[model samples]
Target: MTTHHPTQTTTVQTIFRFLLGGALILAGTSHLTWARTEFLAQVPQWVPLNGDLVVVLSGIVEILLGLSLIFLARQRVLVGWVVATFFVLVFPGNIAQYLNHTDAFGLNSDLARGIRLLFQPVLVAWALWSTGAWAAWRRNK
Candidate 1:
């Protein structure tokens, strides 16, 4: 059996995960405070709930996702799924921002928002790797 050396990858992954998690937490916290209006403006008109409530709920979810990313190791698969699901769920918000000509995460231009959208898949990949799904993929292939 070949032993997998997760040392380097783990170090890099831990650093990335920590940063990503911290960023999300900060973003989520703002939804509860300073940036609430900005987040509300981005909410699609089609969503059934009150915009403020939605923002708060989304903030809660993001906080949970961030916490899970930082604290949940053995349940990495679950964490990965949460991150992936969050990405999918928030995609429409991104599209809405693009359609309404609004800035994303305080970005200045449509081009910046468009560029940031490209990272969703990369984040999904990172979530998967954080869960060791990449290792499984390599081993299976």
Candidate 2:
């Protein structure tokens, strides 16, 4: 089997990471003001946190994660880890919404909601992989 250089792999992964971060930044911006309330509606009742607090916290985190990926080039490894962790941390909110049948940002759905639940893991994987996190672990071993 042919082998790839570590630098080449790192470059490709960095591009993917930037793209994903940009997308998330945009997604997060969509929820800042009026969108915040709309997004808050999707949070399930089972979540113990106050709805407003959740909205604020989620927005801030999305922005931070996006910014870290874009600006923290030297610390890519840490950024990757943080992004991956954030995804995992927020996943329950998605699941809670799915389970509760709550409207998400007022989006109309037809299996889209369920589709989103599946998509979350894919997103998590993308963030992890694009940040070279899987590769990093291999190296540290």
Candidate 3:
């Protein structure tokens, strides 16, 4: 009887995942502390919660997701899906920042903010690709 071992993630994918995780951790830390006020620019005014509370909560969630990305290789597919969903869920904030002309993170002009909005999908793709979620999903289908 043969016991099958899951294939290891490639070196490039591992490195990219780590980089993404590190970026998430740093950004999450900024959300809770130094960049709290700056993050407010992304919060839609229509949101019922206090902006600070939203930032803090999201920061905690980011830290958890980032850590999972770094440490949970066996569960990478699920993590990838969750991370992609997270990117989707938070996209409105990016749109709000662009529409409201809020200056944060040095994204002062509408062009800059609009450009920033374009990167969210890239992040979603990164999460899915780096973790092999897209490939796994395709293989299963």
lDDT per model, in order?
0.77, 0.76, 0.89
> Which pairs clash in the backbone of model 1?
none
Candidate 1 vs candidate 3: the lDDT winner is 3
lDDT string for model 1 (17-91, tens) is: 777678779989999999998888679989999999999999988898888878876665567667877878888
Query: Model 3, range 78-117, lDDT digits (tens) per residue?
Result: 8989999999998999999999999999999999999999
Between 2 and 3, whose TM-score is larger? 3
Flag clash pairs in model 2: none
Cα RMSD for candidates in order: 2.8, 2.8, 2.8
What value of lDDT does candidate 1 attain over all alpha carbons?
Answer: 0.77
**Superior candidate under lDDT, 2 versus 3:** 3
Q: Write the per-residue lDDT of candidate 2 for residues 1-109, one digit (tens) a residue.
A: 9765432246777889889889878867866765887778666677788888887778878988898888887677777788888878878777777777777654446
